[model samples]
Target: MRTDVLHAMRLARIDLTLVGRNTTVLFNVLLLPLLMAWVYTEAVGAEKIDGVAGRVFVLAGLPGLLLVFAVFINLVNSFTARREELVLKRLRAGQPSGPAILGGAALGALVLYLAQVALLAVWMRRSEGVTVANVPMLVTVAVLGVALFCLLAAAFSGLTPNAELAQVTVLPVLLVVLVGAPIAFPAGTLPGPLGDVAALLPATPVVEIARTAFLGGDHLSGGGAALSTGGQWMAALPSFAILLGWLVVAGLLARWLFRWEPRHG
Candidate 1:
């Protein structure tokens, strides 16, 4: 690796270490899963919805949620905090390139998401016997989701005035995921138009990919099927295009709008 890459990695490690020590981070990483598991189990039970159990929903949905939470919500707050402290401004004075700085922050979020995935896997295995089938697709979604959302978070942070408001910025994304991701039951029951719309959402493809891996292959077809064996690659192509488009737009927006010193600066 280049010297700048190494420096960026070091900075990423330091930021991730600091985040790991935060109580709020710990709560979101650890406690929130348990609460979600308990609440989902109570609400959905063990019966099959669209040929899958409530437990499968908990198993698949939790990881995707964490991916969004870490990449979108947590990273936005981190960027805002760093900007407020002039950390971003100081870093801009260094040898590291702009991409290196952002890449380092994204690497930190990826590490956190990986840790959360491990925890979620252990819980799912012990509690619900969740074993993934389409491992490749699952991995793709997780990696791409992280990248897309990290850019989104950084771009969104450009509009945020402070770290406190950063928390509020997550609300719209969170609500969409929580209320719109088709997590309450199964995708089989969704109305035709609504299901079609949900399929196009950034997180839905990832969630569907996760569901196919953990639950089974039956949910891998039609409007809500996580992945179609016939057009699986094709289906993924659109999402990849969308994610890349968003990444470009967000990167451009951040470049133009992000205030390193602060609104006051």
Candidate 2:
């Protein structure tokens, strides 16, 4: 057990090291969220959600932006790249267990995921004077959302015919998160039935929870109250359940479909 843990950690460290050396990926990981924050603010055009200002609204959207581009799509291509290269197959023949190997492969993305969150938080706090209302819940949702997306990315990557198809294969999630879900617009602005459907999507809850956490200006309201046009803290319970349900479902799918050997073999 300890051996697998150690191996996972070592593999994760190596991945992080490689991430540092890869200039283009590193640049995008650092720049994309910041760029989106600005673009979203401009697009929002002085709009507000549930009384929160436009800048803050853009701040809340940071997690979803990072989740899709930085975590989900990036990981989809990453694992597919590894699989196409037979990197995963070579690792499978080594000492680490399958679960450990997959977990380590995901660890780097998760780290990048969390780093984007922290960077955006700090950036927003500095520029927009935003502050986290509930650190625990905020961290919980961020971690959970990242894990969920990462697992889905793994499943998507594993299912893909080849690495070159990642761009096409990943469009559904990109569309769901970016176009289908409520990233740039208020959830309330959507039609009622449509909002319900969007609520069920993965990116919705991540945005919802983050919006809930940043609902207040200075301090996050301690008591769960009516927070946003979509839902409040307690009202967010269903979204949490949805995210958890998707996590389990996607996780099982990944476990079932994930292949260590090359798909051709």
Candidate 3:
């Protein structure tokens, strides 16, 4: 492997170790998702939507929350914290290139989120009988969601003045994301134009793709009407486009807004 790659790997390991040592980060990474998932699933109850368990629909949407809480939000906090401490500056001054530094920091979150996803998959399979029907779409959307959110975090962190301020700075975007996401409710159930708008939210496509991948149907259609692999792809094409668009936008934003040092420094 190249030197930069090795450096990034070392940084990623350090990040993982830091996360383990930080009780707050560890809780957010490990328990927050499960708590949120439980609350959502409970709200859904034993009710079925379109002949599919409402809980399954809720579980299928887990990736959206995971992306936000486990990756995006935490990363914003992580970046801002590092920047304030001059950790990022020290890293940049070293041999690791810009991409390597950013990649290393992001990888730890990605690895944790993937582990949670794996646990979610196993739980869904055993408890809900929700086997992944469209693995490719699932993986594709997951990668896209992680990449886009990581960029979003990096860019957003640039606006944050300090680690303490990150909590406040992230709320507005977090609120918009949570509300826009098809989490507590289905996007399809939204009336006409509202549904169209929801479809455009960054979280929407990720959840939609995950839903189809795990349950084999669109959110509105429910899992009873499982689609074939080809059908799943076709159904998810619009979502794919949406994610790709967000990825481009996020990439641009990261380039423009990402800061190597604290804003006030």
Flag regions of model 1 displaced more than 4 Å: 216-245
lDDT of 1 by residue, 57-157 (tens): 75676666776677788888888999998988889888777778888988888887877777777777887787665567666767777887888788888
Query: What's the lDDT of the predicted structure labeled candidate 3?
Result: 0.83
Best by lDDT: 3
Candidate 1 vs candidate 3: which has greater lDDT? 3
Per-residue lDDT of model 2, residues 1-265, tens digit only: 9998889889889988987998877776668667867887887766655566666776776686788877777778788888888898888888988878877866777788878888877877897787766666677788888788888888898788888888899888787777766666666567878867876787887887776766533112223244443335566677688889989998998888766656874
Candidate 2's displacement at residue 16, Å, is: 1.1
Q: Each prediction's TM-score against the native?
A: 0.86, 0.89, 0.94
Query: Candidate 3, residue 210: CA error in Å?
Result: 0.6
What ranking emerges by TM-score with the best candidate at the front? 3, 2, 1
Per-model lDDT: 0.71, 0.75, 0.83
Return the clash pairs for model 3, or none: none
TM-score of 3: 0.94
**Candidate 1 at residue 219, lDDT?**
44
